[model samples]
Every structure is written in C-alpha cells, then in structure tokens.
Target: MKKRFGLLLALIAALVMLVVPVGNTTHAQAADNSLEKIQKKGVLVMGTSPDYPPYEFQATVNGKSTVVGMDVQIGKKVAKDLGVKLKIKSMSFDSLLVALQTGKIDMIISGMNPTPARRKNVAFTHTYYQGGYDIVINKTDKAKYKNKDSFSGGTLGAQTGTTQYNASKSQTKNTTVKGMTSQSDLILALQSHKLDGVAMEKPSAEAYVSNNKQLAAIPSDFNMSSSATSSAIAFRKGSTSLVNKVNKTVDQIKKENLVKKDYLPAAGKYLKTNTVNTSMTHYWKAFLTGIEYTLIITVCSVFFGFIIGILLALARMAKGNFFKNLLRWIATAYVEFIRGTPMMVQVMFVYFGLGLFVNLPALTSGIIAISLNSGAYVAEYIRGGINSVNIGQTEAARSLGMSNGETMRYVVLPQALKNIWPSLGNEFITLIKDSSIVSIIGVTELIYQSNIVRSDTYRGVAPIVVIMVLYFILTFTASRILNYFERKMQHD
Candidate 1:
C-alpha cells in the first residue's frame, strides 16, 4: 500500500508539471504571425481615448451603441482599408500609447504626435492631421494675455502629455501651469475660472472656443518651437508592414482630401482651429509618482489577501456542520457581493463612507477594503484546490491511524494547494489590477497619482500612461512569480 501511494504521488506531480506552463517574457512581443492571427481572428483592436472630443467621445446615436469622434472615424477608415473588423478599446489617453508598444493593439490613430520618447518604442505613419498648441483664457482675462509673456506669474492649464503642456510648463517661467488629462477638462477649468488661461493645440482650442462664448484664444506671437505637431498613426516598433500600410493609406486619404471630407466633417467641430507650441518634458516626475503608488497598492493588497485567503479556505473546508457551512456561505456571499458590484462603489464605500462611520486611517481603510475584496475570491480558489485532493488519500491516512488533523496537514493539504496554485496566481493578477480602484479613495495608488498629476499639471495622457505601465509591471511580475512556484512544485 505504501509503495502504491508513493507511485500515485509521483504520477500526480508529473501530471502537474505537464499542466502548468511556466511564464516567459516572449509573450510580451507581437507574434511573427501577427497578420495571420488578425485575419483568422477577424478583428483589429485599436486604442483611443474616448474623452478627447473630436478625437474620441461617447455617443449613442439613433439608439446605436457607438463611440463617435475624429479618431473613431479614422479608426473605422483604417480598419476598413485593411479589410478587417475594427474594435475600439477605450482607455485613458496615455494607455493608448503603451498599447501600441506592447502590440496589444495594431495601431493608434488617436491624433498621436511623433515624440522622440514615443518614437523609441513605436513607429509613426505620415502626419494624418495638422496639430499645434493654442492658448486660451477666460473671456474676462483674454484682453490681458496678448502674448505668452503677458501671462507671466498667472496660473495656466494644459492637458498632460500634449505639446501645449510641455510648452506652457517650459516657456511660462513665471506662470504655474496646471496639467490635466483632457482638453475639454482644461477648457472647463478655464470657464470655471479655476485656471487663468489654457494652452492647447489650435484645432482643439478652436473646437472649444467655437462652442463656448466665455473663452477666447490669446492673440500672441504664438511662441512654440514646432509649426504644426503633425498628428500621426502609431504602430509597434519593427512593424514595418503595418506602418507602411498605414502611411500609404494616410497619404492616399490626404491626397484625396478624404481627411477633410470624412474625418473633419465627422470631428472638426471638436478640435481647436489655431496652433500652439510643442515640447517633450511635461511633468514627468509627477507621472512617475502615480505609477509608483499603483505598484505599492497592488503589492500590499495581494500579499495581505493571500495570507487571509488561505486561512479562510481552511475554515470553510473544516468538516463541522456549523463552522464549515457558515464559513462556506460567508465566503460565497462575500465573493458574490464584490463581484456583483462596481469596484468604484466599493472603493468609495471604504474610503469615504466607512470612514465617516469610524475614524479609521486612510491606509488602514485602503488595505482593509482591498484585502476584503480580494480575499473572497482567494477563498473560492483555495476551496477549489482543497476539493481537488482525492478522497481516497484522506481515508487511507485515517485508516493508518493518522489523526484527521495529521491527514489534512501531512497528506491532503499539500497536494490540494499544489493543484489550486494556478487559480490563486490568476486571482493575484486580477487583484493587481483591481487594486487600481482603491485610487478613487485617494490611496495614492497609480490611478490616483494620475489624477493628482492631472490636477496639478493639467496634463492627462503622460500621467495616465505612467499609471498603465505601472499596472502592467505589477501584473507581469505577479504572473511570473506565480508561474515560478507552479513550475518548482511540479518539477519537485
């Protein structure tokens, strides 16, 4: 019997080795079979920011589910030209750039500029739309800002990641430039008198001033380095074929004046009519801080939750009718409640609502909320793993005069944990991302950092991109660690 049991254990371990494929960094790159994969998959994923009007915006037209804007139209044309279905993945303005770098999407036609930093990671097609920065001020203050120099010492606003943001930050030596996430947001701030003036691309500014009579573009010599920051399409580095195709298509569209007829008509009402300066360094430090926060929150939540989850799983699996069933129900209810609700609500509940009831510290609230939310799912994963253990092994251990505790501790639990390891790893990956929700509670997690950067710098895209990269690193690292343990256990 002992020999048979040992053979069975060896067989189980071997099976585990075959089942769990270890992680590899190679998956980060686009496959050589990219084109074929798309042809077979029948869909082309494109990244764009839905909040940037005339570029991308949420709209329900004639009862149709659609996100309409300039970039959306451009995306449609590009996809149609490629003879593939287009699927838009709406994300923050900054994440779209990383999506291109990671090859998660084929291209970005979201009115992106060809910056030196961005060019290092992704290639750009010909300038599809002419872009430049424009300075905007409250109607009441427009008379004072005749030129860039006049606005010295005044507070200015610019959307993060835009050339306008860089220009305003660099050129306005005396002025404090507030960076935000979107042009619309900047305009709103200007109108609300929260900002003295705003520097934005001409097309985007024109779009705003045309709609709101309370704002006007400052008539200045328009001190900016570039004449027009030619907006272009972006693709992953080394994707020569895709880049070439987009370049050729954009040229054809431009030559045919289809950009005016199709893209402009669909989105022109949304961009600024004037041009503004472009620059590179637009609040990089602030953006980096946001990414740091996101990483910290993800790590803390997953670590704490893992410990609590194991304990809860053990309790749920206990044989007693009361504690076991009660724990099982509790775990089920917790998971269902969290999974059923929006993460945003839960974040607010913990951060704002619960705090009012009890004066708990912010860090404590953040950790508790994230752990509670994550622990529920972890419990289910642990339970599944425990249940996977063969019943015969437990019975045999008991028949051998082993106590129930000894059988569970020495014979059953180890095997069960190994089986459920993958699920637990997957849960951690999810937790790493879901932790972003805690940022709403002002936990200074990655997303919150982005918000702060936007609040201070008026630059939205760069801070958001930083946050996305931070999240990617966290998830990627978690995935690798999980795979490492899974592989080690299997091989052993």
Candidate 2:
C-alpha cells in the first residue's frame, strides 16, 4: 500500500510539472513553422490595445459591446486575405510585443511604430497609417505648453514602452515624464492635473479633444522623432511570409486611402455619446458578462488553490528524506517564486509565455495563473494551521492504529481546516480582486469591461465607478457566505 501510494504521488507531481513553466523560455519558433501554424489553425489572432480610440476601441454593434476601430477592420481584412478567421485579443500596449514573441498572437495591429530598436526584436509590416506626435493639454493651459520648451520642468505623461515615453524624457529638458499603462490612463492623469501635458499621435490627441471640450491638442508640428510618425503591424522576428503578406495588405490600404476614406467614417458612426447612466444602460449586458467571468474565475481558482495547498502541506509534513526532499523543494520553490513575482507577470507568462509550451485558452490560462499564485499563500496558511493543532492529537490517532495517511486525512486536516477557514476566506476575497490583473490578457473580466465602456462612452470615471461598486458587492457577499460557513464549522 505504501509503495503504491508513493508511486501515485510521484505520477501526480510529474503531471503538475507539465503546466508549471519550470524553466521555459517560450516555444521555439523556426522558419516556415510560424506561418504554417496559422494556416493549420485557420484563425489569425491579432493583438491590439483597445484603449487607443479611432485606431482601436469599443462600440455597440447589433446590441452587443464589440471591439471596432481602424485596426480592427484592417485586421479583419488581413485575416480574410489570408483565408482565415480573425480573432482579436485586446491587451495593454506594453505586452503586445512579448505576446507576439511567445506566439500568443499571430500579429499586432495596435498603431505600433517600427522604430529601429523594435526592428531588431520583431518584424513590422509596411506603414498602414501616417501621423505625427503632438502634445495635449487642458484648454486653460494651452499658452503654458505651446512649444517643446514650454514643458521644461513640468510633468508630462506617456504610455510606457512606447516611443512617446522616450520622447517625453529626451525631447524636452528637465521635464518629469510619468509612464502610464494606457492612453486612457494618461488622459485621465492629464485631466486630473497629475500631468501638465501628454504626448501622443496627432490623431489620438485630436480624437480626445473632439470628444471633450476641456482637452486640446497643440497644432501638429508633430515634434516626435521621425521613427515614431508612421504606424505599422508587428510580428515575431523572422516571420517572413506573414510579414510579407501583411505588408501587401498595408500597401493596398494606403493606395486606396482606406483609413481616411472608409475606416475613419465607419468608426465615427459607431461612437457612443458620453452620458453616465445612458452609457451604463447601453452597456449593461457587457458589465453583466464581465461579472459572470469574474465569478467563474474566482470560484475555479479558489477550488484548485485549495487542492494544491493541501497537497503541499502534506508533502512538507511527510517523512522519508529522499522522496520527501524532492516534494519539499518543488513545493517551497513554487511558493516563493509565485509569491515573489507580480501577478501581472505571472498571468502574461501563462497566457503568452506559456503559449510557447501549451495552447490554453484565455479563461483557462487565467485560472491556472491565479490558482498557482493563490496556492503559494494558501500553503502557508495550511502549514501554519496544521502546526497549531496539538501534537497529542496525532499521537492519539497513531495509538488507535491509524496509518500516517489515514491520520492526516481523518484527524489532522479537519482540525487544521477549522483553524484556517478565516485565512482561506481572506485568500478568496483577495483572489476576487487580483483576478482583475488577468484583464491584461484580454480575459473580459469586470476591469476589462469597464475599459470598453469608457473607450467609446468618452466618460471615464463613471463606468469605473460602477465596476468599483460591483466589485465591492462581490467581495462583500463572498465574505458573508464564508462567515456563515466558518460559524457553522465552529458550532459543530
């Protein structure tokens, strides 16, 4: 029985190794395979940051909140030209390059610039649109920031990992540049007076000014470096065939002036007015759908976390140094590694980083990332609870002829669970909140929905306020339910 049980545990641990990126650097991409995979999959995944309006943003289509904009339509056309279905993954601007490198997406159409530094890492298609960088400021502050010199010693905002960020730091002397995650966030910072000005493409800056009277873009001397002016699609390095095909499409779009003549007008028509309640009412379905995904991810992640926590605790408590040490190292390394790293990094690594190794869906990848993260903290709670139980209880079980496994199963865990219930409850609540980070991978959770609502609505704070309330309600109800269970356990 002991030998059989040991064999079973070893097999389970080996299986766990398959999903944990134990030392993976992304799946290897070779010549021909990159394009071949897409043809075989029959779907081309295009990544973009939906927060960049006019280029890519959200709008209502047939009574549903759909992602639509210049790049989205162009992505559709490119996918059609390649004779494949199109799938859009909306993510943070910074993660787009790494996502392509890891094979999480086939291409990126997020108004990216093909700067020389980027060219070394990834290939870019022909320029799809032409524009220049400009500064946006509150109308009242226009005179204060007319030229590059005007921003001297003032704080400015730019999207992180973009050419604008570098320009903000180098173009003007002594200006404190704050790097934000999205264009929406940078705009909010500018409005809230956290930033005196923001650097962006002329069109993006103009789009914001058109929607909000208080905001205005400087007339386009477009002071950015030449490399930042033209926008293009991105692909993994050496993806020759895919890049060639996409460049052909970009050439056609430019020849026909599709962006100015067709895409811009179509995007304009889909724009939603910026009314707080009206936006909420129109986008209620999207919010509800987001809530549903959030709940599902939370429940599933907690369930798996508990399983891993209990197993790690048992491995730590077990005897037999050789086999035990192996399990202990695995468990301890996982706990410390996950707990030490940021959840955002873990989720991206799982979605795209792990995509190099496996083909998990967005929802499944999110659950796995959160579960591993939760397990680390959960293990400590479990280990502490088990240690707190009187040692005499285990001796008594042994005297009654219980095997070590049986004693742990029938005696130790039940008491430990009682002590750890509150800790477990706290972990669950935190998971509900931490799950928001997975939105960076385009999971469509509450935070992602809030972004979409704000994208087209043009009113930012109100939609997020609604999501804040929903998150509060979710955590509050979960706390009450957990308290009920904890009380019942105590009474029994």
Candidate 3:
C-alpha cells in the first residue's frame, strides 16, 4: 500500500507537470534549446552505471575519481572532442534510458546491446563491439559434463535479462534455470555450489574461469555466435543527430585500435588482461547496473529515513503522560531491535520471508527493507540530538510563556540539531556505505555492481577497488553537504 501510494503521488505529480502551462513552457524550452543549452553550458551529461570492467570501473590514478573502462575512455574522448566537460551521472542501465527520455542526460554509453524491445524507446549508434555466450562451471564438475549437450538435468544460472539466458533456456530441457539479476549473483551461486553451472558471455566467462582455481569456462572450440550483438550508445528516439555523432566517434576509436593498446590502461586495471587472464567483457553491463541500484538505495534510504526520524524524535520529545510514554517505548524498541540485529537478516526477512506471506515488487521490497533498517539508526540519531539540547533553554522558553511546541521548534531543536550535525553526517555516510548490504535482498547496489564486474571480467580486486573509491566519493559528497548545512546553521 505504501508503494502504491507513492506511485500514485508520482503519477499525480507527473500529470500536473503535463497539464500545467509552466510545464508546457519548460518542455518547449527543452525541445528547442537542449543541444544549444548543453553547448552553452559546456557540459555533456553522459549517463552510465560503471561497475563493469573493460567497459567501466572505478580506479585511483593520481588520487582522483577516475572512472576507467572502454566506455569511460570513449565517453571522455567524446566530451573532449565536443569541447564540453563530461558530467557523468551513474545510474542503472534501465534508468539511463529513462534519464535520456526525460532530457536529464544528453546520451547513454553503457554496455547496452540494441534489442527490438529497446529500439522503440531509444535511437542507437553503430555497433561497437561483439561477443556471445559460453557456459561456465567449476573444474570439478567439468569432468561430468564435458560438452554442452550433456548438462541435461543440471542446475544452471544466468543473469536475468541477457541473450545467454535465452540460449541456456533452449539448450537444456531438464535444466533448472535460475534467473539472477546480475552476473555476480550467478558467480556467487556457482562458487557456493548453489548452481552446477552458469551461462554467460564467452569473454566474461573466460576471464572469470582463468582467475579462479575451482572455476573454468567451456572449451573455446564450442561454437558461439559472433554476430552484430555489439553494444552501442543510445539516445532518445528521433535524436538521429546525436546518434550520428556518437557513431562517428566510435569509428575513430576502433580505427585507432584502442581496444588492443589502451583499453585496460584507460579503463582501469580490469580492462587489461594479464598473461593468465581471459576475456570477460560480457559481465560489464550487469556490474554497472548493480552499482546504479546501490546509489539509488543509498539516496532513497537517507531521504525517507530523515523524515521518519524527525517525526519520531518530535513524538518522543512531546509533553504528555500516556502518549509520550507510549512513543518512548515504541521508539526504544525500534532502536534496540534494529541496532541489535544483523542487516543481512533484515534484508532476508523482507525479501524472502515476507515474500512467502505477501507478494511484493522487487524494487519495493528492496526500498522497504533498507528504509526500515536505516530508520532505526536514524531514530537514535534524532533522539540523541533532541536530548543534547541544554535544559536551561527549555526553562527559559517556559519562563517566557512559550508553548511546549514553540520551545522545541525555536529554543531546543535548532540548537540540538546543530550539536548533532557531525553525528548526522556520520550516520548518512554509514547509511550510504551500509546500503550495499541490500544487494542480498536483490537491491542492486555498489557491491552487487562489483560482483557483476567480477563475474564478467573474472579479474577480482581491480573492479572492487575502483568501486570502493567511487563509494568514497559518494560518501564524501554527502559529508560536504552536511558540513555546508552545519556551517550555515552555525552562522545563523
């Protein structure tokens, strides 16, 4: 019901934006001057979720937020050639298209393959790179199923939305095909013995199998299609001009043989294959998508949690006999339960446990799970802030004939929140970092994105390290914002 209400509110807001004259004028302005506005602003807002390697990943070069990968390098080149600064907005692959459609971004450069269903929404550039499916398995299991045709009754896993899944579904009649959201999940399942094997892109599978002693991909002799299932940049439908420019840029890059020479260096360590490494570009999209979800979970959890905490704090601080006591008890129980339990358990209860009793949308389940978990910590922060207010301030307000509400609003809260500003900032940072835990509930966050990268590239360490830096940048920004507000309040 909460989800439905939120959706309804969003729909109503969208409708209002559509019907209002102001919205009409804004839309008209967007249509007329979008390109001009971008040129004038000197920024090309490129949207991509960078969790995949050889395509995108985070790495520290000279201690900056260096988003590396083939796509990252290419995007930087595109922006540089256009004489515009690149403002890369990280989001899930699905959300990248939405950003383009909403005119929030000029173009998308994620590892998005052109599909019939997607073509209706976005225009695509020329095909850039191509590869196809391969089956991966642990070395111990390889002896049992030496060939693809032999895995008739095996438990198989594949990323939820990929061509490899279609192939896996058709190839094995008695196979239990587990549709995981990202390549990382499949890899984890396979490693943990939850799956006998996984069907994935040949490059990514090869890369993964090469890195681990227990894992290995099917032999290279196994014929996989090398058709134009290549990835391409996407723009809103009818944006032929932008598509053409991107295509030209891609041609220039490939003509330069950037893939063989600088693909790894420019894209971070994940793109560069060592003597022992194998090709694993296929897992890039899944990893990037996961990172995007992590960011979403962080933002949503913090935003909603702030409101809930504020309300709860105010309730607990209220002057009443029965009501205050009741709120105090409820708040205390909530804090203790949440702070005492493991976040992993909380996630499982919401996704799998509650799912057994009631149906829930995947995204809704993730949001509710994280929000509820984060709320407990937020409530404690609020309570601490409320309690930190000097008792003399309340007494002074009361002597001044101020109401209890006025005392809180003017005399107590403002001062209390100021003292707790650093703690609030710390909580927000913790929430952002901890949000990665939601992936267990299938909330595709940063770590989940890293899992996707590792699954696709089979090069561990590099992609994860890159993601850690990205996360640091994210948390740092939150801290800066908190500090800004703190300073402003201090001055006020």
Candidate 4:
C-alpha cells in the first residue's frame, strides 16, 4: 500500500510538470502591434469619462448629443496623425484603465494623469497638457474658506480616483475628504451644503464657475509633483509602438502650443453652447434615447435570466448518480457566488475579465452581466417555487408510468411557475431599476444619458428629476402589466 501511494504521488507530480510551462515565458507575451491593429481597424478608439468639462464633456451638435472637449481634440489629432478615424467611448473615470487593459478601447485621452501608481499598470504618452487644481465652493462661503486649509473640520469633496482627491486627503489638516464617482455629484453635494468645497482640475472649476453663478473657485494650494498635475494619454502596457507613434502628436502639439491656441478655445465654445438651454425639454431626444436603451437592456436580461433560472433550478434539484450530484454542486456554488458579490463588481468582471478573449460591445456585455446576476437570484425563487409544489402530484405523475423528466415537465414545472408568478413579476420589476448598473460600462442607459444631460446642461438637479420621473413611469407601467398577467394566472 505504501509503494502504491508513493507511485500515485509520483504520477501526479509528473502530470503537473508536464502540464505547466517551466521557464522563459517570453513566447507567451503578446506582440506590440497596438498601433498596427488600430490602423487596420481604421478606427482609433479613445476611452473617456465625459462628465469633466473643458477636458471631456457632453455637448449637443447638429441637434444630436456628442462628446467634446480638449481631450477629444487631442484624440482627433492623434488619430489624424495615424491616418485613422477617431471613436470615443465614454465610461466612468475609474473604469477607463480597466477598459483599456481589457482591449475595450485602444487608448485613454480623458485628461488622465500619469501618476506613478498608474504608470506601473499602463504606458503613457508625453504630457499633452499641464494642469492645476482648484477648489469649487459655494459663492456665499467663498470668503469663509481661503484654501484647502480653511476646510478644516469640514468635509471636502473630489472625484474619486483623481489626483485632486488624493491631494485633498493628504494635504488637508483636520479635514474630511469625501470622494464621489462624478464631479457633478460632488458639486451637487457642495450646493446642498454636504461639502465645504469640491476639488477638481482648474479648467473644470473655471467651466463650472462660469456656468453657475452660485459657484466660485479658489486655489487648492496643495503641494504636488509634476506627474500628479500633468495630463497624458494612456495605453495598455507594452504598447511601445503605439506609445511612440502617439508621442509624436503630443510633441508637435506642445511645440506649437496647440492646446492653448486651438483646443481650449474650441472646448470653451462647446461649454458656451451647453448652458444656452438648461431646460430638460430641450434635451428630449437624449432622454428618449435613454429610455430606449434602458428598455432594451431590461427586456433582454429578463428573457435570458428567466431561462437560466429554470435550468439552474432543475440542476440544483438533480439527485441520482455521481454526475448528477456534480451538476447540483456546480449549480449551488454558482448561485451562492453570484449572490455574494455586488452587481457592479460582477458587471465589471464580465466586461473586463471575460473581455480578455471576446470583444463584446458595451451593450452586449451589460446584458450578459446583468442577466447572469439576475439568474442567480431568480434561481432561488424558482427552487423555492419548485419545492413548494406538492410531492403527491409528482408521485402521481411518476406512478402513471411517466419518467422523472416527463413528470417534472408535465406536472411539477407548470404548477411551480404558476405558484411563483408574483415573485417572478417582482424580480422583473427589480431588474428594470437594476439595469442601470450597466451605465458604469458606458451602455448609454437612462442613468448614463442623464449624466450626459447633467454635464451638458450643468444643471445637476434637473437631470436627476427628469430621470427619477422617467424611472417611476417605467417601473409603474411594468408593475401594472405584470399585475394584469398575475391576475390572469390566478383566474386560470
């Protein structure tokens, strides 16, 4: 027995040695063809967060909402130099890096800073623009607070993952630094007196103060290194060829001072048009597009989620042989893992992790992620519903010379679905709201579109109110439709 055990261990070790690569894994590294790939595709995709004005923000051109700012101008120049068309992909600021690393976008030109921590993960071109920080405050409190130090004992806000946010946290004494995902949200917090001031780039602060009379700007006065204050374009690491090509554009822009001469002025013109009509009515088309995408995501997720739930429910209930038990274990584990993680993390994982191999479109990735999440929850409801069915009915079907599959199909599932109709309807309604989670990946759902409207109009609250009402109407209408079906199910 000892010799047999020794032999078994040796066999396992030998198998492991054969399966794993030993050394010198350079052959595994991907080739540096980033620039060639972009040119072949004929489109240089630039990722950005469009909420930051003067750097990247939403604007309406030719009656259509569009992304425009200094970063976009730089992206266009880089693409032109490469002899390719430019495409802008907008996501949250924090998601930009993940999106680039996952090959969802070719480059990032969203006024991104080349901090040391970021440089370790991605390659950066030469600095395209040198920028500084400013603190936005309520006009009434402008005199009360002179700089970062004056915010002592009060909360100062900044966009999460930004240099200003880090500076606010490190440089201030006896101050609470609050971070939010959106600059518009931070500004809203300031107006509502939730924050003493909001820290942001100087250009963005100027744009906000010029647009809103209630706001004023002051110097941040936080010590920073040049890398913390300089903006550059980011690419996936090891893209030396792409980085070198884009650096030429960056160098020419700096030599000619094109940012100050042309780009900033062009971005300023867009900011001017943004405030001309702050009313939600003028952006009706934007809201309509939002509703359309929202419905598309919710409907697709529900349909796929329900199908997946049914399969998982049946799999979890399986009991017979070794293979059947394995299926049950897998189904159970999947449901638990999905329920344990946040939907946002799951969405990002699906978009970035699964994205390593397949180049899924943002909308497609959103639906797939949301559907997988909803399925895990829906499985529980289905399992409970299936268990709630009387055992005697299943026994009766079995005794009628029917197989287990047939019994489940003819007797158990129909009754189970009927019993869980209301729960299923509730899940459907919940998904309508939860579908907004995909907005982080730039799906252009209602929340994303509303963010654009807020950035474009610079009236943060109005866009929120519009989306709130629109969501209520969507969920309310869905609830009524579900009720009608539930009534029909009961009557039958």
Which candidate has the highest TM-score of all?
4
Q: Assess candidate 2 and give its lDDT.
A: 0.80
lDDT of 3 by residue, 1-492 (tens): 000112222343353335335655456535654445556889887876554444664443442334567777778877887678998765443345544655557887766677666676667777666655567898888778665566777787865555556566666678787876556556777877898887765555655565566797874223434332467777766665556666788888778877557764544354333322323343455446655777777778878877777876666656669878898778777768877977765654564445534656446667777788777777778788778877888999999999988998898888877887788788778877887766543345677656544643455556666777778788888788988998998999
Worst 10 residues of 3 by lDDT: 1-10
The number of clashing residue pairs in each candidate reads 30, 1, 8, 0
The number of residue pairs in model 2 that clash at the backbone is 1
Q: What's model 2's TM-score?
A: 0.90
TM-score ranking from best candidate downward: 4, 2, 3, 1
Rank ordering of all candidates by lDDT, starting from the highest: 4, 2, 3, 1
TM-score, one value per model: 0.54, 0.90, 0.55, 0.93
lDDT of 2 by residue, 220-330 (tens): 343655557788888877778778877888899999999999998777666533323355777888899899999999999999999988888777666677988898888
Q: What is the Cα-based lDDT of residue 415 in candidate 2?
A: 98
Candidate 1 lDDT tens digits, 352-417: 344433655445666778887777778778778778888999999999999988998898878987
lDDT of each: 0.64, 0.80, 0.64, 0.86
